[model samples]
Target: MQTNEIDVRVREILRLALKTDVPEEGSYAREDDPNWDSLKHVEMIFMLEDEFDVQFAEDDFAKMGSVAAIVALVEANHAA
Candidate 1:
């Protein structure tokens, strides 16, 4: 996927996962953002899988605690 495509997918996934009608642009949601929580984690994972068509590796679960982390992971996988 192209970089812009990855970005679009990431934003959409994050928005759906966090249950936010609109996602902040150019920056990730902060750790303390009300949308960031345990329950949302599962929802995020599912949305990510559906969006990326990639099942995250086992280690990814622990690494994907924050939006920045997911952005990195998605970039890495898309680049791979």
Candidate 2:
């Protein structure tokens, strides 16, 4: 998928899992979202994995802290 498409889908997943709209300005990290607690982070990771049909390694989960990061990871996985 194109980067823009991946970005849209990732943002959708973020909205659903984080229960909030993604920020339009700058890179928004999980810590930036008050709603993104530990439980939600796990849930979000699972959702992203399922959505992209990609299995993220345990280390990858730690890297998924922002929209940009997730999109980049998903784009790379999608390419693979």
Per-candidate local distance difference test: 0.73, 0.86
**Candidate 2 local lDDT, 1-80, one digit each (tens):** 78777777888888899889886546788778999888999999999999999998788888898999999999888777
lDDT of model number 1: 0.73
Q: Assess candidate 1 and give its TM-score to the true structure.
A: 0.74
Residue-level error in angstroms, candidate 1, position 61? 1.8
Q: Which ten residues in a row have the lowest lDDT in candidate 1?
A: 21-30
Highest-scoring model, lDDT: 2
Off by over 4 Å in 2: 24-26
Work out how many backbone clashes candidate 2 has: 0
* Cα TM-score per model: 0.74, 0.88
For candidate 1, lDDT tens digit of each residue in 25-55? 5666546567778788878888888788777
Clashing pairs in 2: none
